[model samples]
Target: QGTLKYSFNAKDKSAEKTYQCEVDRPDPTDFSINCVGERTKLAIDIDRNLGKSKVYIDLNRFAGERFGFEAVRDPQTKQLD
Candidate 1:
């Protein structure tokens, strides 16, 4: 796990939030992705054939200047297509 640290301030109020980010160790069994440039598409092929699962893209995960990502999924399958 890693620590996420940041600070915030306002004219009349100030706040700080510190959270823990658990590093995701790659698991080839279920989830996989195809990435090109700044975009990433995730596909999960589960054993149960659950049709297709959808994943939401969080912009904050690619907050740094050196990297970025956006989610593109099919409307029918709701999986990255």
Candidate 2:
């Protein structure tokens, strides 16, 4: 298992807040990934040469008020995986 720590600053009309969270990496087949953010968004990366491999993210149901993903990568090389 792998863990990732993220932090971001978010502001609305009234105020601003800094948020942080630690999220565990999801399974390779589980393309539906999410980030906890006030204004949430999804980020997916895929290696076309790696067969049908792809990444999917859905950030509509996050817990935190602000969040983001730094990066996501498989343990093996791009060619191997």
Candidate 3:
């Protein structure tokens, strides 16, 4: 468990916030981490066996956009796509 700090600036305004984070490894090949704040949340997952990873973010009222990323590796070719 840990804490994450973030700062943002827009035009003439600036803000700072802190988030609490947790990490877990439920399986030998899998790992997960999550962080949450007053109005934001973030999550990440990784699977070593399958060579897959993902990330998710939500910035409730702080930003107008929410985004995520997903990636997979081709086992035979050893290439990520």
Top-scoring candidate (TM-score):
3
Candidate 2 lDDT over 9-79, as tens digits, reads 33443455322333343555444333343544444444333334333344456644434333434546634
**Better by lDDT, candidate 3 or 2:** 3
Q: Give the candidate number with the greatest lDDT.
A: 3
Q: Which residue pairs of candidate 2 clash?
A: 38-65
Q: Please provide, for model 3 over 1-81, each residue's C-alpha lDDT reduced to its tens digit, 9 standing for 90 to 100.
A: 999877775443348777899999989999999999988899999998899999998987867677999999887897999
Error of 1 at 81 (Å): 8.2
Per-residue CA lDDT of candidate 1, range 1-81, in tens? 545444556433346554444434355434433322223222223321333444333334465324333345565666764
TM-scores for candidates 1 onward, in order = 0.28, 0.23, 0.69
Cα error of candidate 1 at position 66, Å: 27
Residue 17 in model 1: lDDT: 50
In order, the Cα lDDT scores of the candidates are 0.40, 0.40, 0.88
Better of 2 and 3 by TM-score: 3
Q: Runs in model 3 with CA error above 4 Å?
A: 8-16, 62-65
Q: RMSD in Å for candidate 2, one decimal?
A: 9.4
**In model 3, what lDDT does residue 15 have?**
82
**Clash counts for all predictions:** 0, 1, 0
